[model samples]
Target: MEFDVKGKVKEYYGGIARKVNNGSGKSCCSGTSCCNEVSKTSLIYNGESLTYLPKEALEASLGCANPVVFAKLKEGETVLDLGSGGGINVLMAAKHVGTTGKVYGLDMTDEMLNLANSNKAKMGVTNVDFLKGYIEDIPLKDELVDVIMSNCVINLSEDKERALSEAYRVLKEGGRLAIADIITLKEVSTELRAEANMWCGCLGGTLTIAEYKSILENVGFKDIEIEVAHIYTKSIIENTYLKDKDLDDVANKLNLDEVDGAFAGAYIKARK
Candidate 1:
């Protein structure tokens, strides 16, 4: 049977939203059954950076890095966050933009949008709006945004080129793209790439560093920079995505070292 990639991602993340809404206290990507507490600790925003947000927003954060820090948004500048999952980045961007600016959060999942709106209301942020839409087909006018930011969400896309093109179309002249996402340093085996669970976990669809830069360039983005923020080792993957499987057997079958050295969380910057 063929796998439905989009369906799988929606199901996986919708479940996460439900869990979080139920007061499970579970992190999105690093839930209790998937990753160890120590591994979960490795993925965090600076404490001071999150001081003003509600506790619900802090707990719902599922990003690998904080793109808001790198976005350098100024007062009165319009900003858009793609895949704005529980509105963590949206709320943070809202703080930076202040009352003069507006921050738009676009997400495909209804449950996530609901959760993000709830968080936005809890934070009493008047400058932010959460819109339900896919990143590949954003619901905004061309040249309307000064900056576009995404956190660990681009890799979840099935058609990354379309998504990047849409991002380019929506940005104003000289607008910036600041994103944090998973990228592969080397290639994974076909078997691993075929797994729906891996794709939903932000692993199956990663592009290599070179390929990512090439795609950004192809989409008319300039001055592209991709910096490795965290490397994912085989052990980490085991604890996070493959915890339920036979680790040793899976490792041997996948030639895990190549896969280990291949994947990392990266910070990507560019301009339209």
Candidate 2:
């Protein structure tokens, strides 16, 4: 089957939201892979209560790092989350921005939007709005947003350059972009790069560290800094793939020797 990147991302997240809402238990995919558990420790286990969200939302968290730590957000400001799945980050941003500021969650998945909306209501967050749109072309006014954040979502974009252009367009001058994503430390093999599974799971379709810096620079962003916040280990790899019985078999047959030496997670901050 031909892989439709956009459709696949939407479908994948929609399923996640559905599971979160219905409490039917999420299907075992790379989204819940053991790698994700290790990758999320810093974001969920540290500095905040994970009690605000359901298990599904926690399981759906795919971010490589936490953007809120570096966002340096101010009160009465407007913050936009590019891939606000389950509104976990959106809700967290709401707390930081306070009652004076507003938080916008833009996601392509209706199910995700529904789940986020429900969560917003449950939490009594009046300052947040869920937007149904693509990040490549944000449905917002220019120079209106003060900060932009995404968690492992930008890497899923079929056109990353276009997405960055949109981010720059909607942000005010000096507004910052703090993205937590899976960035390759070295070049990905041709075979791995071409795998559909890798892209959907936020692995195979990553850009090298230098390439990520170059794109931000070309997009007219200054004070750009891409740094490693965490590295995915083999133990994490085994855990993530273990959820999928079939994938576990293949994962064992093929030795992923290149897993640990290169870092798989990073945080990139830049200003427009």
Candidate 3:
């Protein structure tokens, strides 16, 4: 059967919103052992950064890295977070931009939007607004935002080129792009790429570093820089995606040992 990529994505993330609302305090993406391990060690956020935000925001954070930390947002600057799930990055950006600046969190899922808005209200954060929209076609005016931030969400897009183009379209001249996302160092197998679970797990849709940088450059972004934040080891994948599966079958298809340097959590920085 063919996979409904878009429908699966919504179903996967919408469930995450519901779980957070139920006080689960568990990240949907980190439900597996491999993901849990990565979350504890790979993702970075200062204690002070999490202190002022609603607890729900921290619980719902599914980012591979903290884009807000790399964004270096200034007070009074307008920032937009594409695919801002549960509003963690958006809230962080709001604090950085202050009362004078506005932060917009654009997400496609209604559940996430509701959860984000609830968090916003709880925190009394007037500077941030969560909107419903797709990353490929952002629901904002062109050249309006000072910076565009995203967290591990872009790789999920089926049309990455269009998404990056939209990101460029919404940014002001000289505006910055700070994103934390997954990238692949080597090509994955066709079988793995076809796995819906892997795609939703932030693995299947990843582009190689060269492809990622090229896409940004093609979208008219300059000063592009990609920093490797964390590399996923074979054991991590085995624990998460390959657990209880036929290890030799996968190894034969994808060469597990050769995939040592394959996957990474990348911090991507660029300018429009």
Best by TM-score: 1
Report the lDDT tens digits of candidate 1 across residue range 90-141: 9989989999999999988888888999998888889999998899999999
How does model 2 fare in lDDT? Answer: 0.76
Order of candidates by lDDT, top first?
Answer: 3, 1, 2
Task: List the pairs of residues colliding in candidate 1.
Answer: 185-262
TM-score per candidate: 0.88, 0.87, 0.87
Query: Candidate 1, which ten residues in sequence have the lowest lDDT sum?
Result: 33-42
Q: Ten consecutive residues with minimal summed lDDT in candidate 2?
A: 241-250
**Clashes, model 2:** 3
lDDT of 2 by residue, 145-258 (tens): 999999888888878888998999999998999988888876546765566555667765688888888888887889989888777666665665323212454355334676
Q: Report, for every candidate in turn, its global Cα lDDT versus the true structure.
A: 0.81, 0.76, 0.82
TM-score of 3: 0.87
Candidate achieving higher TM-score, 1 or 3: 1
